[model samples]
Every structure is written in C-alpha cells, then in structure tokens.
Target: MASINVDFSVGQGAISSRLYGAGLEHVGASVYGGFWTGPARPGDESRSAPPVHIGWREDVLTLARALRPGILRWPGGPFSQSYRWRDGVGPRGDRPLRFDHYWAKPEPNHVGTDEFLDLCRWIDAEPAITVNTRSARPEEAAAWVEYCNGSMLTSAGALRLANGQPNPWNARLWSVGSNNWDMGAPEAARRHNLFARAMRGVDPGIELTAIGGNPSNQSEWDKVVIGQTAEQFRHLGVWAFDGVASVEGDNPEDLFHAHVASAERILWTISNAAYRLDEMMLNGGAYVGVDGWGIWKQSRQGLQHDYDMSDALIAATVLHGLHRLAPRVGYAAWGNLVNALGLIQATERACWATPVYHIMKMFRDLHGTEATRCTVAGPAVAAPGGNSPVRSSRPPYKGMALIDASASRDVARGRYTLSVVNRSFSDRHDVEIDVKGLPTGIGATSHLLRAESPFAANSAKEPRAIEPFVFPIGQIPREYPFPAHSVTVLIWEETPGLT
Candidate 1:
C-alpha cells in the first residue's frame, strides 16, 4: 500500500492564482478564428468596455467564463517580435493588415489592444501584455503602457478614449522579450533597461518582467541580465516545454513519462533561478513568471496539440509542481487557450471542452492562499523513455514514484485541498492519507480525473467523453483507491477559525 502524509503546520509558500493562468497568442487560429469568433452586436455605447464593432462567439464566452483562467496574456509569443501596437488599434476597418512573421500568415488586426482587454474582462481574468523588445523601440512600448494605464490627460490615454474606452485598463503585469535572438546578455540588458526606464517612468506602480533566456544558456544570461537590471525588473520570465515529434505515437505510457518529465524540468528551471534570485535580489520580492508553457509536439501546425486523458494527467502534474514551489514561482500560463494547442477547442458555430480543460478547471479549486506540506512514500517504477526539449537536455529523473501528491490550505477559511496522482500504467493503488494538525470529517469529498483509456480524448462530437467523476461522500476516507494514470483532488469544506 502507498502511504501519504499531509502536515498542515508545515507551510510551503503562499500560492498566487496567477500560477493557474493561461495565455493567448496570435498564432494559428488561437486568436482570429478561435478566441475572437467575430460578428456579436456592435459596441454598446452604455457600457464602459465593450468589443466594439467586432463580435464574439457566445458559446466560447460561456465556456471561458467557467474555465476562468486567472491571467490571460495577449498579442504574441514570437509574434510580438514584429507586432506593431499602432496598427492593431483605431477603427476595425482601417486597422492595417500585417503579415505575422512567426506564423507566416496575414493578420487582420481585429482583436487588437482594446478587444483583448474587454475579452479578458468578460471571462473574469487579469490581462498581461507583452512588449516587442527586439523589433520595437522603448518609446513605443512606453506609449502602449500609457495607452492602457495612463491618465486621460496623457496622449495615449486620450487616444484610448477616442477609440471608445472611457477609462484606463491599468494593466499591471508587463514582460519584455524572451529569447534575446542575436543579442547577448549585455546587449539584452541594455535594451531592457531602456524599455524599463521609459515604461516605469510613465507608471511607477506597474510590475515589470525581464526575460531569463532559454535553458541552453539560461545561467549566464541570468547573471548578465539580473546583474545589470535587477532594480528595474519585478520578475524573471521563462518558458518550458517537453513534447517532441517522436513521442506522437501510440505509446500511452511513454507519453505519461514524457509529460511528467516535462513537469520535473519546469520545477528544475524555477529552482535553478530561485537560487540566483535569493543571492541577487535580497531586499526585494523574489518571484519567477512562466508566461508561456505547454507541450511542444512538432505537429504540422506549429505548437498545436490534440489533447487527451494522458495530457490531462500531465497538466495536473505540472500544476501540482507549481503548488509545491509557491511564492518562488510567481505565475504560469498554459501556452495557447483556444485553438492550435488549446484547452477548449472551438469551431465557427459551436465549441467543446477538451480533456485538458477538465483538469485545469478542476485544479482551480485546489489552489488557495497558502501551500502545505505533503509527501508520498511507495513503490517506484522505472521511467525508461525520455522527452526531447526545444532548448535543453532530457530530464534527470531515472525512475518515478508510484504516488505523487501536493496540498494547499486556505488559511483564512480553514479549508484544505489535497491532490494525489497515481502514475502506474495498469494497477490501482490503495493509499493511506494521514492528516495531521487539522480536523477532517467536516464536509469533504473526492473528485477523480480518470478515464478507461489514457488515449481517450474529448472532441466536438463527444465533449463529455472524459470528465471528472465526483464520488458521493459524507466524510473523507483514510484509505482510498487511486486508479492507474489518474489525478484525484480532495477538498474540505470551509471551517471558521481553522487557520
């Protein structure tokens, strides 16, 4: 039998809701076709913010509201390299059409700055904008910031008013370019400082992020960039991926290992940088932001993924890892939210939730203000396969623990959420969950994320093929059965003064 222990007194760090955020890039059908399925009624003159002229798919909006990603990044991943803020704004008909250099497609610039912010509001998410550090100037970035956040007296803010928005969006989170391209650390720092100084000069309260480069040369890049511009940046931004083209076969077990390996690599990257931040930014807040992260299966359509139950388990593993490394990891956003690597797949008339969507949505309730300690001791399985990364080497984990778990406590409400992952290929494990220093037996239940086959996925036709099964219960059990390759979340009801 597997044994799991959760100690409520042993607090890990506070968890930020942004850690469960998802990003939207202007790649493939993610934006134009998937997110902004145009033609809702024109902008409402009465409302403070509206999707002017352009329309949205009601089905997508309804589903997105339920998913409720805490943060949503806009504009680009690499597409931001060449994206011009000026062209995306103004009248919908007049906005110039630009060729998306990264995706090599024509972008109509319909869902520009204003529309994206409004979309975020509809879905109840905080908006995060990216600046074009490589292709655009510092002044241009400052202007974009001013347009979104500055007072009505400012020129950019005045332009925003003329464009239909009555008040400022006041977007707080901003990140500079990742992957310095041709420029080395020194040059990247200089450019970042220029942008930071200009942007911060406009709004002193805004939080700024600087790129920590890719894994291949991350350490040296961190030294140079952090060494030079430590005072200017609020967080170091990084991206992680574990899927490769070769792993796109029929091996469900291999896919499970590859994704778990990806989770390990992500935590490793955060831990590696946390060490430096501790030494460097001692006086200030220390946190890292994973703005874009997901599996990078080398599909014909760039980073698009046909997500399945296996992918859902991997998503839970990654989220659990983030919970374990709280406060250190400030934020994380799943790569693409709509189409072409999306959690919810959409068509013109209808939309449906994917298996990954169920996991992400279910995991939302598991995270609270504080993280608690949870450890698992059990038999191990040999993880023979490896995943090829976009920048770094394979994961260092040789074998895997049969049971992996993490816990979070809402100190204010006296409620606790615990998650356990059973990574076995075939057999189920009956586990002992020992709770300490907290009262259980108060209203509690378990929700399991599992399917008959790891390869099972949700599509437009069978949207509910693989969904969370909520077990009827009165009190939480000490020993529970965890199915093979599944994630189980157990939540306790709110208790007064439990903290």
Candidate 2:
C-alpha cells in the first residue's frame, strides 16, 4: 500500500471542448433500429411498437448530453465511402436503397443526412460527417459539405433546401475517409488528397479531418497526408488528422493493451510537433463484430469481447492515455457507436449499453478536459507482460501502479476532481490525498463507482451493476480504503474564505 498527493489550483486556460468529441458510427442497427426505427415502421411489431418520436431519439441524446460530447461522427466507418448523402436525406419513399458493405445488410437510407443533422441538433452536438473518400470524387465530397454548410444559393445548397431543410446545415466537422486501408495505399492517398482539397474548396469554414493510416502506421501515413495536405489544404482551414483502430493480437486483453500502447504513441507523436495541428482523431477499441483484428470475427464470444471486464480496463487505460495527453490528442472517436462492433447493442426488442459504454461514460462524466498532475508513492501492479488473460502484447511500462490516478482542476467552478482506479486483483489498500496547494475554503464531495462483487457487470437485464455514489469530505482524510477493481473520483470545490 502507498499514498498519493495531488495539488490543484484554479487556472485561466480552458480545457478544449474537443476533448468531448467522442463519436459513434452506425453499421448495424445502431442508426436505423437502434436510434431511428419508428414504432410505425414495418418490423417486429414488438420492437417497433414505440413510435420513432423525439423521445426515443432523446434517450440516446440524453446519454450523449450527459457525456457532454462535443461532436457525433456519423454514417460510416468503411461504409462511408459507399454512403451517398442524397440517398439518406429526403422522405423515406424517395430515398434509394443500398446494400451496407460493412454489415452485409440492407441500408434503407432512412436515417439520412437530414436525420443525422437533426439528431445532432437535438443533442446540441456538432455533426462530424464522414464523406466518401475511397469511391466518390472530390466534387462529391465538396457537395456534401456544401449541402450541409453552404448558403442556399449553391447547387448542393439548393438541393438541401429543396429537401425541406431551408437553412444551410452549418456542421463544422468532416472526415475525409473512414478506413482508408480498405483501399490500397496509392488509391487511398489520392482519395485522401482529393477529399481534403474538395472539402477545403467547398467550405473554408469547416474543420476537416483527413484520414491517415491505422494508429500503427501513423508515422508513415502522417508523413504522406499531413505533409501533402500542408501545402494546399492548410490555408483552407482544414485541420486535424485521423487514424483507424488496429491493435495486433487475438487475445482480448492483449488486443486492448496493444490499442492502449498505440494510443499513447499516437499522443506522443502528435503532441511533440512545434506547430499545433488542429486535432488528432485517435480511433481505438474493438470495431463492431470484428475480432482482435479489424475484420469481423465469427465466434459470438469473440464478438462480445468489448463487454468483458478486461476490455473495460483496457478502454479505461486508453482513456487514461488520452486524458494524460489532452494537450496533444484533440479528438477521440470510438470506431463505431451503435452497431456491429459498438458500445451499445440493439436488438429488435431492446438495447443496452455495454461495458465499454459504461467505462467511456464514466470517463466522460468525471474527467475534465485539462490534465492535472498527480503523484503516487504506492506499490506498483506487476505488469503481466502480455501474459495476463487479456492478451495485451505490448511491452509493459516500468513500475506501473496497482492504483492508476489522474487529476484535473476546473477553474471556472473553482473545483478540482481527482480520478483514481485501483487495478489490483487482490490487494485492498488505504489511500490518502494531499490537496494543500488548491485554493482554500472549498467544500468537497467524492463519488465512487464500485461493486461489492468484482465480477459484477451491467447487463441488459440488470443495468445498475457499477453505478456512482457520492460522499462528502469536509476534511481531507489521512486514509481511505480503496476496494480492488474500483474507480473513485474525489471532487474539491473552492469555498471562498478559509485557507
């Protein structure tokens, strides 16, 4: 057992709202059945019974709102290149039907561009549209942006107005490619440049995210995309870099650890640059229906790996890396939001948030945009060194702690929140905090998200497995027992008078 001390103070710098740019993609029922299917829609009468009213959409919106998400990436991963905005926009009867490549299902195009924009509006989230970089031309990409953000005078803008949305949909975020590797390198590079140039040419006001390679190949892809785009699109207000998720290994834990390590590497590379790049979109976690590799796995158990505790821990660790390096890593979008490989699973009858969802929600709810310094003098958790049941093949960090902790101070509210997670399987240790440096006269509250049963989880049937509980801390305690396998968030508020 060891003790940790954290010092926090009000600062003038504000945490980037982009830290909250967590997004999801719809491949399976994630969009249509999960978020858009109406009660009146022809389907299983039981599942479709609830009309597709604002209420149903509001449920997912509520979740996104609670997370204070800054942006919602839509429509595709690999599927984006084939997605046509026109097909998904107007009335359902007029929309053309298409086959979904990723999910091998029929895409009715019911949840089109308009619906997605409307969804973003309802949740007050910025829409991050993924254009067809692999298959569509630069003009096509430009048209999508023009339809969304251009004034009603232009051709695409006029089409948008004719579709019933009179006002131009001023969405600021756009992704040039989804999974560029699906296409070869030469073609991918050409497509990436084309979309980048087109997007900039169409709407100089929009922030563009040009696709790089998988995180593993970031150095190579960054050299190409960033280097090439820097010359032409840099002046067009295009900003941000995008990477796909690729963790090498079959074991779930190993895959998780690999992704974490890769995420750390992405942060390091992007942060060390002298000139500030707009943002780096680090895509991590299991892709829907995919196994350890980015391709779909057949085993049902393999498909549900994201629901496991080991995956949850890995997700948390990935988030830890993101939060720890927030200065450099500007944006993070979970590969897919609703279907196939997603945080939320939707059946015709119901939908439930998975373990990854809970973990991300926890991070979103408790952690702030800015990273604070935390020092711990405690026993280190032995790195299983890729042997742990979770199969993380990445080399271990030296002297990693059984207790992982990070802190942030919110200057506006004059408050500090410290998040601590004990990853130990057996050791239950008492913890202490030294917040003497924070501005004084502040009240404090602590919230713990833990379960009496280490294996307890939130399921579709029982969704309350690991929820949050708050405790008041009038005085800083010298010690508090931290149960193994738990995450604790301690909040300190500035009270205004006493030191």
Candidate 3:
C-alpha cells in the first residue's frame, strides 16, 4: 500500500492545451503511406475550402480525431532541413515527387501547406509550421510564414489566395527545424537568428520554435542557441527520443524496463533546459518544446517504432511530468503522427491504434486545465543498470518508487484528475491519495490502461490487445488498487471536508 500526498495549492503554472501536440513529418511512410495515403474518397470534405477535397486516409483521419491532438507540426524532422515550401503549395500534377535528402526516397508533395492546414481545421488542432533553415534561404522561410499568416496585401498572401486559401491560416507555432549539427552551435545560432528575423518581420505576432537538440547532446546545442537568439524564439524545441540508440539485446523485457525507466530522462531534459533558460534570464517567458519524443530503437521497420505497453508507460509518465512542470514545458509533440514513431500506425490494409495512442487519447480527452504537485511514498523496485535499454552516463540509482504520480485540477477547482503509474513488473499497488483542500465523500471514477505484460503490442489486427477501460472510483479518500505495469487515471469532485 502507498500514501500519496497531493497539495492542491502548490504547483507550477497553468497547463496549456498545446502541451499535447503531435508532429507530422515526411519521414518513411509518415506522409506517403501514412496520413496522406490513397485517393480522396467521396465523403472527404475539406473544411477550409468546403469545395476542394484532397488526399487523406479515412481510417487514419478517424484515429487522429480521437487522439485529441492540440497542436500539429508538419513537413519533416531531418526532412524539414531538406524540404522546400514552394514546391508543395501550387498544383498537384505540377508538384514533383522529388528525391528527399533525409529519407533518401521520393517525397510526393501531396500533403503540403493547404492539406495540412485543412487537417488542423478538420481535427480542431492549431497549426505549427516549420521553416527550412538549412538549404532553404531566409526569404523562402519568411515567404512560407507569410503564406500561412499574412494579410491579403502581402505578396505571399496573394500567392496563397491564388492557391485557393482566401483566408489567412493564422498558424500558431512556427518552427525552424531541429537538426542543429550541420554548422555547429555558433553558426546554427546565427542562421537561426537570420531565419527568425525574416519570418518574424513578415508576421511579427507569429510564435517561433528554435532548435534545442536531443537530450543526449543538448549541452552542445541548447544554451548556445537559446542564449544567442533568446529574443527570436518563444520555445526551445528539443527532440527527445529516449531509448537505446539501437535495441541492445534479444531480451525485450530488459529493453522494456529500460525504456520505462528512461522516460524520466524526457522530463529531465525539459526541466534542465527550463532551468538554464531561467538562469539566462534573457528570455523569461521561454518554454521548452518537446519537438519530437518517443522510444528510439532499431526496429526492422526502420524508424516506424512498433509501440507496445512499455512505450505507453513512457508516454503516460512523461505526460504527467510535463503537466507538473506546466508552462515551463510547452508544446510536447509526439515525433511523427502517422507511421515513423507515430501514435497510430497506418497500412494499406487498415489503420490501428498503437498502445501509445490509447494512452494519449485518454490523457488528452480527459486533460486538466491546472496542475498541482503530488508526492508518492510507495514500494520500491530496482531500476535497471548497465546498458540494456540505452547507455546512461549518470550513476546508477538505488531504486525507483513503484508508483509515479502527478496531480491536475479543473479550472473551477470543483474537479480533479490524478494520474498514477505503477512501475512494478508484477505487483499491483493499493494507494491512498491524500488530496489537501478537497472535501470528503465526493464521487470519483477511474481509467485504467494495462495488459498481461509490458511487451504486449497492438497492431491493425489486434488493436484491442492493449487499451484503456473506465471504472468507477466510488468515493474520494479511498484506497485504490493500481494494477502492476499500469496507468490509473482518477477523476473526482470535492464535497466539503477532508479525506
């Protein structure tokens, strides 16, 4: 049994809905065979134009809607560095299936600016466009921003009108790619400033995301890029793919636990960057954007990570941590939304929700407006040491608490959501959550996500093998049993009194 104390009064800033962002890039089948597969079916209605319908897979679209993604990033990861916006905006047949430098395959410019914006509109998600800082000039990058958010009088806006978007896209988060190693930090910082100037000059109000490299190599990129161009960007975009650089061994269990345990590294990277930005004091309002995050492994399917329950635990834990961090961490986007490192997998036969999709759907659909601090005192489990999952330079830990948790509340304070994860491989936890300032005997219910083993994965044929189920928590201040290797999300209203 465990006693978890949650103080409603103390925590970080209010949670932004953008914290639950999803990335859509042209890596592998992420665009080609994934979100933008097949031809436009009869019922495919474009919400933006209403008259013009385009390429999209219905099954993938349906799953995306259910995921409740708040923000959508596009173009590429490494592909962003190589993509050109101009090639994609004009006509369909006129668009070429150019040989992409990053993925080393032909990228058909099907789901470009227009289709992507329409997607954001259909799914009710804010648009976050990325500018190609490397290979593409500052002017080209600026024109793309103008094409998305400028007035009718602007040249790019006129071009946009000719291209069928009469209304400005008014896209929110504007990113300048995250591949920062080409020119080194100093040169990259300079180039970032140049692109930022041109893009912001076109639309002064547009928010920008600067490259804040992956956690393993962040030290070389973050402080320099952030310090040199703090005024240029609103969020430091960090690509956090936590797992083995390559799947180290045959034992999936070892890699699974290692993946679960290393999830903390995601939060740590954000926290560390946030602290550095705070220390810099140049950009007081800067937020750390989890530009792309998930487990990185050497799967047979290339970067298309076949996510299992282990990845779900990482997703849930990282989300809870991001919630607790609040405004400090901004725009946490899952790497690619369709195939390569995506939440939902798309194939020619059918599309199905990966285990990560269910976890994301649950947390997003039942997201909290406010964050609160919580402490867990529970049974301990030995954390994996050595380098089975991924090599870690940090010293080995004594043990990890079986239960990891975070607290969230509705804006009105009448309702609260507590997400608890049981990291134990075989032991369920009976935990008592002490919610201070909440009343007694209020009604409560819970959502649980679990399976027989963490290694169990979901595919098109067996999507329901691992999923979330809703149950009634009955009352507040009661001992709840959280299943082993599971995520338990509880929601309750407060009546007057203590637990």
| Best-fitting candidate, scored by TM-score | 1
| Clashing residue pairs, backbone N/CA/C < 3 A, model 3 | 445-473
In TM-score terms, candidate 1 sits at 0.92
TM-score (C-alpha) between model 2 and the true structure: 0.80
User: What is the lDDT, from 0 to 100, of the residue 269 in candidate 3?
Assistant: 81
What is the C-alpha local distance difference test score of candidate 2? 0.58
Q: lDDT tens string, model 3, 1-499?
A: 7889987667556888887888888887787766675465465353221122256766778888777687888875778888888888888879877888667788778778998899888888888888887788999999888888898779999999999888999986888766757678888889889999998888899888888766666776777888798888898887776664323453555445555776776777878878777778553888888778877654544674688887788888899888877878878888878878888886765678888888888787665688887888877755553342333533233566668888877746477778888887777788887777555667777888999987789877886788788867576556778888899888775542222
User: What is candidate 1's CA lDDT for residue 154?
Assistant: 94
In model 2, which runs have C-alpha deviations exceeding 4 angstroms?
A: 10-14, 39-48, 54-61, 182-187, 232-310, 385-399, 453-455, 495-499
lDDT for residue 335 in candidate 2, whole number 0-100: 46
lDDT against the true structure, each candidate? 0.78, 0.58, 0.77
**Per-residue C-alpha lDDT of model 2 across residues 212-315, encoded as one tens digit per residue:** 55435545555555555554332111112211133335543334333333333333434433122443222221001100111122224223322444345445
Superior by lDDT: candidate 1 or candidate 2: 1
**Estimated TM-score per prediction?**
0.92, 0.80, 0.91
Error of 1 at 282 (Å): 2.9
The top-ranked prediction according to lDDT is 1
Ranking of candidates on lDDT, top first? 1, 3, 2
